[model samples]
Target chain A: MSLELIKDILLATVPLLVIFPSLFAFTTWMERKALARIQNRIGPNKIGIPCTRIGLFGLGQPAADGIKMIFKEDIVPRGADKLFHLLAPILALIPAMLILCFLPLEFPWGKFMSGQVQAFLLDSAVIFFFAISGLATLAIFMAGWASRNKYSLLGGMRAVAQMVSYEIPLVLSAVVVVMMAGSLNAKEIADVQTGFNWFVLTPWGLAAFIVFFVAALAETNRSPFDLPEAESEIIAGYFTEYSGFKFALFFLGEYIAMFAISGLAVTLFLGAGDGPFLAVAPWLSVVWFIAKIFGLIAVMIWLRGTLPRLRVDQLMAFAWKFLLPLSIFNILLAGMSHHVTVAYPGTTAQVVTWTVSLVGMYVMAKGLDKISRSTAKPREYLYAE
Target chain B: MSILGGGIFKGMAVTLRNFVGSYFSKERFITTNEYSWRPESELPQSIGDYPKEEGEQLSDTTTVNHYSRNFPMLLHDTGEPMDTIRCVACQICERECPPQCIYIEKSTEKKENADGKPQFYPAKFDIDVSVCMSCQICVEVCPFDAIVMNSQFELSTPDRFGGLLVRRDDLLKSNDYYHKIHPQEAATRDERMAADKAAKEAKKKAAAEKAKAAAEAKAAAAEAANESKEDTE
Candidate 1:
């Protein structure tokens, strides 16, 4: 039992040490370089050791930045709540890191290794992922209330509001995926998505996916939905009081959150790590898994590079009006499909489910548009009474 | 258009074009953002390939026009090992300068020119670029065409007194470097100088010819007087 516990600990620890730093660094480099390219500028091309031309085109930059952050002075405010201000960064960082524990990095190995590769397995990992990610909002709140700055406090409030607003749609969309698979196990969901038969290949799954992706963007505090940490408006948001290693911790948390969220998205919609001929090679699935994660991350960066932040009122409107309703309807469609597939069985069942769900979703979307349009137009006032 | 997230898709397409357009056809980004710290030698002269297509070779600094005048530099003749600071310590630029950023100390030891008149050059020339507004007043006020502004703009430095102070040696640029940056202006200046030189030479030649004619006319008149006297006797 002790040996088993040690082996399990090693499984989690090995990926944590090797993968997290390299992953975070790569994401940082990729985001900057891609953002630069999108905006038509060269970003971070010069940071490296003194002599060589082998700078890897700003790959060394994150390391340079990380080192710089470590050496920076850690300052604490005089009027700050000493305990929580000290704990804020730790609170913010731990949840993002812990989310990685449930994310399955599945690879196929026939006889030599375990068939299903995961750091740890839980039957209710989908529930665990949503539950754990929801806690990151608390961390943001903790940082804000503790910092003693009004801006930091406001940022903490925004984080709470946005997270609460988006979490409904986020969880609702994932519930649809969970309903489709009929199991909460991450690996089992991936197994169903084998051979290009991903849930996203269907209309209902596609809508859920779009909703989930947008909510995930909001949840992770990415741009267009990045009001919680909008640097221009909020002056570093909850992290305003943080500096040096404390600031670096917040950054680390964000990067890890991005990885975890995108990793979960890959598993849920794009067939976890399932690709064609992945069964034959087995170990090749992990490569496919990583590629999908990076691909999703690239999309996130593209969105960040492209879109401007929404107004606070506009942001709230989008969550309540569009995402909330759409996700609920998606749950309805997913449940119906599951019911029909079990009751009737075979291709006719699939065809019936497809037609009903697609048509139902289309009708609901039109109804939503009309409702929004009507509500958007306010009556004019004749007098300034 | 009422399309779902229409603005987002449109903005995304625009960025996608910029991202992809940067690779295939770079003529779109006409003016690259010139970072102050990036070395002039390391700047991208033309839009480089997107990182995926080709390995981004560090590009040359952009070809700036004659008017992009960031800072002023002294033009030096390449013939005599960078001989002559074009500024003669006239101080016309010094007085006319709005910022009064230029400092000129006249050389006490003056050397006589071909005309046997003493010519003065600056002993110590400095332009506090930190203070200079880059208005090109010094270039305008220079009488000898010595302070023509050159387009080497990157003047960012760490030190205030040491780094921001433009020295005489660092300020002097070769005539070729000036022409490369400001070809039309350099050419026009050279033509004007050549025309002035030609007119001066023409005036000198005419004076010399008139002097010879006067001396010959005096000799002829003297001979006539002698002949007439002899005939009368």
Candidate 2:
């Protein structure tokens, strides 16, 4: 019985560990190539198949980078807290990897199991995912404080502030889904939206999804919201003192967190593995889940390439004044929409609810934008003509 | 007044267009493809085969246009570079160069140039291209029409100190080569040099004729005076 329990646990957790890190490697390559194309430059086309001149469109670049990162000298500052500095990357990575199991991705191997096998099948799995992912902020702060560098400290503080500020909208937006599904269980939430009824299809769901995505971007420290590790401002933020494999760990942690958050986004709104051919071939759901995650990741990469980083003030204002109020209003709208759907269950009722919710969300968003906008006064030049 | 965050979508659309357009339109996007590596056959052997058109996209290291000027090269008329070298070793370019990258050692004995005029050749002419700013200052200061900018920019070498110091022989490119690289500029330069040469020859010829006429008149006057003296005696 004990051995079987261990086996089931391994079966549930092993694939995630094997798959996501490898996906992180591929994502780095894809991001470089995509960003290069966007800027009209060829990126990493030279390095390819080893021991030969034949370039395989630079696919082997990630492996080469990994080797380089491993072989690099690990540097530590004299005044640094050596133990915490060493522990920080590991700490940052743990929460990110821990949250991956809660994504509600059902594999074909689950059928062979004697009992239902999941990494952590909790009643409040979504809340647990949020609670664990929030620990990544502590890791950032630890890295910053341990480094004994002012820039690193500032980066740590900014990350703490940004992640904390954005977490409100991030959780609140997911709350709409949780409320709709009538459970905080990720699997149940996903199961409720089984057939073309993705939460994002509805008006409030769309608003909630938008808010969630924007806040997710902040949560992952992805650009426009990537002010924490802002290279120009903070010199790589908390990991400024880290070098070699430690630095690589931080990078891996960050990308893995991206995958984790994107996966959650898919689970919450994109109908988690629910696709057209699910009835014909049940196992294709895994592919559908991963594809949806990749879709979100692709959009994230596209946004990173498209948008510039927001200023400190703008980032705070965006999260607090804009996303905070908007998400709260969306929750109320979602509640009203839910009651309306229950009271009048017909096509005409559905149409009316959709229109009213859409219009209401739009008006609220416009009002929030107007309120949050800071009026800039024209500059008066005294010396210059 | 405007829709909120509409600018982000518009910007995303522009990037999307660029990302997709790069694959189809090689000329409009991904221009580095034109000048990167290519097969040996397409690569230029001499300056004649080099691309001279204003915006002609080629697939070789020699993918340079007419207006793209780099470091200075000495222009020779024809035949061997040393035999027909245009530089008189005047050191004008060497003295006038902003960075003083040019180093010239004047020959002890004079050698006849392409025009059959005796001129001091540069025995040891070297230009440290590493120090050259590519400002075309040496070309501007050169009165002999010897120095002109070469369009070849792929000057990377393993031997930093020795390889970058371009010797006199390496610097000497044929006039035909210059004409191939920069047709319009070379044409105008050649025209001006020809006109100057012609004007000098014309001035010399007129001076000789006037001197001969004056000598003849002086001889006549002297002869007339001698005959009159004989008659008086």
Candidate 3:
């Protein structure tokens, strides 16, 4: 049992430690590059190989940045809570790794490698992923509280408010997938999404995907939803007092969390590791999974580069007044379809139900928008004579 | 504006357009130029490529002519064996400088210049660019037309305090440099100087002629007075 535990830990940690850091390094570079392109600027291209003189189009940037971060002076505030201040980043980072244990790196169609490809295939992995992710909220709050700074405290408060508010909708959308699959197992969820139709193609699943994605943005503190650490407003939020490796840790945690959440989104909606010829080459599933995650990340970067941040009130309203009600409706719609699809799997009843819910969603959204529009921020305009 | 998710889709479309257009389109050329790094030999090569011929302005974007304020400089003769500074140690500029950044010391041991006159060259000249307001007041007050503001403002240095204190050698630029930067001004100054020299020469010639004619009249009057004395005897 001890040997088994050791083996499991090694399998889990190898990816988490090795793949994630490299992935994070490159993802950061990608985000910077993509954002630069959107804004019409060169991102990073100076650090060239010494002898060969080939810069490789700024591939050395991440390595240079990593080294610079490592060499930077570590600063801890004089009045900080020494324990939690030190512990916060660690707490924040561990959840992403913990999540990697349940997350399937490879989901071979009808070909099992005794579940060795995945670190763990727990039945309750979906709920567990959500639960583990919740720890990050505490970590952020701790970082803020420990710093004894007003900005940090406010950032912590925002983190708590934003995370708790959006988490409800996030889970509700996840529950839609759960109800449809009739199983809490992640593998089962992904399996159900196979064949010609991915869940995102379905009407109800489309609504749920939108909700899930927006909520995921909030959950992971991606921009447009990144109110907790809004640099202009809160001065780097909870990590204001952190420096050097500690700050780097926070950054790493953020990127890894993005990966973890996007992975889950893929599994639930995009059909994880399910692609053409997956029945023949099961390993190709990993490639499909990675490709989907990267696609989602690219979208995230695009949104960040394009959209302005939401006002605090607007952000709260978006989570509570907008996303919450929409997701609740989505859950009901998903449950009804799940019931129909179970009795008569692949029947027109499912299609009818999907169509009904979609129409209902549209009408309800329009009604809610009408009400909100009346009460929302007024748009004053000038009259031209 | 109040439509359901329409604004977001529009914004996304704009971003997508920028992403694609930045690469392939001339109209949407990325304003970002990676200009930080270059080989040491690149500057002269670039300068060579630029049209240095008269009457044609440079069309290069990298050309540094956007409101380039040449720093105040002292014009100097390049090949002369003697100390060649146009400034005659005049203190008008020293007293008139608003910021009082310019410092000058007249040479106690004056040197004989080309005109065989005792010339008071500045023994030491320095300008604390840190304190300088760059108002061109010193340039205005210079009686000898010695000081001129150069069209080069790239005077940034690593040292925050003392390094910006420009020395005598650093402040000196060739008259050619001044002409290059201010062609019109230099031409006008040259014309005025030439006219003044011509005026002085004409005055000298007139005075010499007048002296010669007066001497001839005096000799004739003395000759007449002597002849009249002889007749009386």
> DockQ numbers for every candidate?
0.35, 0.36, 0.40
When candidate 1 is compared with the true two-chain complex, its DockQ is: 0.35
In terms of docking quality, model 3 is acceptable
Q: Per-residue lDDT tens digits of candidate 3, residues A39-77? A: 766667666675676877687888888888899998888
True-vs-predicted CA distance for residue B216, candidate 1, Å: 81
For model 2, how big is the iRMS in angstroms?
A: 1.8
Question: Which scores better on DockQ, 1 or 3?
Answer: 3
Q: Which ten residues in a row have the lowest lDDT in candidate 2 chain A?
A: A376-385
Model 2 chain B scores worst on lDDT over the 10 consecutive residues at B52-61
- TM-score sort, best first: 2, 3, 1
TM-score of chain A of each: 0.92, 0.96, 0.92
Is model 1 an incorrect, acceptable, medium or high docking prediction?
acceptable
Writing each residue's lDDT as its tens digit, candidate 1 over A1-385 gives 6885566566555766578768898889889988888877766788766578766687789988888999999988778888988887888778788877766675333123433367657999899988888888988898899889988999999999999999989988988888878889887888888888798888788989888999999999998898978898989888999899989888888889988888888888998778878657866777888889899999999999998898798789889998899889888888878888989989999998999988888778768767887887565677322
Error of 3 at A123 (Å): 1.8
Q: Tens digit of lDDT per residue, candidate 2, span A135-200?
A: 999999999999999999999999999999999999999999999989999888889999979999
The whole-model C-alpha lDDT of candidate 2 against the native structure comes to 0.88
Off by over 4 Å in 2: A115-117, A374-385, B29-233
